[model samples]
Target chain A: MSLLRKGQQWGTFACVWHIFDATWQDPFRSAHLIKKYLMGLYKPIYHPLNQCGDHVIVINSKEIALRGDQWQKRVYFHHTGYHGGATWTLAWELHSKDPTMIMKKAIYSAMDGTLQRRFTMQRLHIFPDDNVPKEILENVSNQIKQLRPVPNRLHEIPQEERDKIPRLIQYPSDYQLK
Target chain B: MAALYRVLNYLGKNVVLTAQNRNISLSAVTRIKEIIQKKEGNTLTFEAVIKPDPYEGRFLKPKNGACAICSSGLDIKHTDVLILSQFVTSEGNILPRRITGLCETQQKRISSLILMAQYAGLMLRRSPKGGLLHPLQKRKWKKFNSYYDEKTIKARYK
Candidate 1:
């Protein structure tokens, strides 16, 4: 809930939510967290090869916080799969590359390295902002959830192939408004 | 002679609990393992006690989120072996039974876990013998080259 005030800050559209560690019985207050906890519980029993977990949409991606000077030091890696193709982009620079990565990495880390990790991760959706056309929210655990985690256009580019694709094409054309 | 008899009895589907305490406390620790060191009784080797039912055939199929046990559900301490075994193995290849001393059935189950980990990007799909480094990558370089083809390069120079 930090106010937006920056020198060169760009806002993004994401399916954002606050990840609270503790559980809440008030479904309306912390419905998304409750659902994530429940879905995570099912992961031990459910098949990992197939998409079993539900998508968690994060809104207001720009508002997410970092504990310390972590934002300035944190870096994301992408390899072209060639000699000297490894590119290290910072947390802020990646906002231009793909604002959603910050959220995606967060969810991916939580899943750890379970066998169903690949399939269960498919359901995770991270949007930068809420200013999109006809946003779909479904009711699951006593609270409404963003049924679809990803935007209409998903980033299917491989890690090695990301540099080949133009950054402009990464976001939906209408994202300027958000 | 008794050790051979015990092995034969266990493999032949004859439970010999009627004999003296069969739990003979196998020495679980080996020089080869550099993984987590817990109490001696906790760490059992794949060859030492793993008894997978080869006839079952169903254990070959990996369950969702579960690692391969003697072709059965995830066994204790064996979960720790899942990550360590993959790390010790040379690369993308799965470890076979003969060297690991695991029975045929348990070996198959562990192999599937390796495949699943690779698919999840936790492990490599191929070995690093020669393929780890990509070399001789030739891309269309236009540093000082001419017109239309050199447009992007020219703009960068400016």
Candidate 2:
């Protein structure tokens, strides 16, 4: 009952701005959300041809997750249309080089193959971190909830709680976790 | 016309060559004789002087100096002016300059800015009710009902 209280308004609005925090969420899930929001599928006024999609701002794209084994097994293929131009890159390596590349590609391929797909894709904004411009921040009217809550960093946990957790063995007296 | 030009050309050449000699041709003196002689091949006739196109040289200046939105010192990214403006339709179609009262450049800027705003989560793009067609274009039940009435229904059933 409490979860239903925060349900988004589903009415057809002329314009809406949405923000998403990509931290620790699956990149595929984030891409799906971005595609859905960009096409404005959640609204009643959504039409395949109509440019009724809303804009979505995605921050912390660098921290997006991949399902187990995908990071090592997934390979992105590319060719430069020249001799010996074919290249294969592992997912983790590609993500490290350009944090937004995977998500961008996911959303790009997910959209319908129409001329308007290019235009709709323009509505997705991705940032590697939380540092969005002040002007863009001011315009964000809504937040798209993440599929999972962000895990707390070790430093954020209370000192007493850390000490209370039982361990099979203790490190040397000189050892420092930091 | 060629003969006349030839005559004028020869006469000038002869005059330059025979400046000391006054032995000029009688045909050259008579203007009627020059007009009567016709050249064997095509003779150059009327050549009309063409006027240059008026609009060709003119550059269009936007009505009040620079673009309307730019002149007002409103930064598209920082300000909500574009989002607040009614220049864009619910389906993200930009209104024409006539309705928006903006110059051509500004209209383009507004459109791009609106798109940017939409992507940045600052604005919404929505479609009008019942798509682009007007309500009047929709067929009235009485008008369209006849097509699907008894005769057609019977034909399909049969």
Choose the strongest candidate by TM-score. 2
Per-residue lDDT of model 1, residues A1-178, tens digit only: 3356331132222222222221111112233353464254434334434333454545545434332233446687889999999999876566555656665666566555776666656654445665433444442223344322221101232445423322111111111110
TM-score of 2: 0.45
lDDT of 2 by residue, B1-158 (tens): 99999999999998887664533233323211111234556863322222332222332233356544544554433124223334555445656665455656656666665544333223444435633322123221211100001121111211
- For candidate 1, the TM-score is 0.30
Lowest summed lDDT across 10 adjacent residues in model 2 chain B is found at: B142-151
Question: What is the Cα-based lDDT of residue B120 in candidate 1?
Answer: 26
Writing each residue's lDDT as its tens digit, candidate 1 over B33-82 gives: 22322455876433223333222432244345332443244342212323
In terms of lDDT, the poorest run of 10 residues in model 1 chain A is A169-178
lDDT, candidate 1, equals 0.39
iRMSD (Å) of candidate 2? 39.9
Which pairs of residues clash in candidate 2, taking residues 3 or more apart in a chain or in different chains? Answer: A15-B124, A16-B123, A16-B124, A17-B121, B90-B126
Q: Can you give the lDDT of residue B146 in candidate 2? A: 8
TM-scores of the candidates in the order shown: 0.30, 0.45
True contacts kept of each: 0.00, 0.00
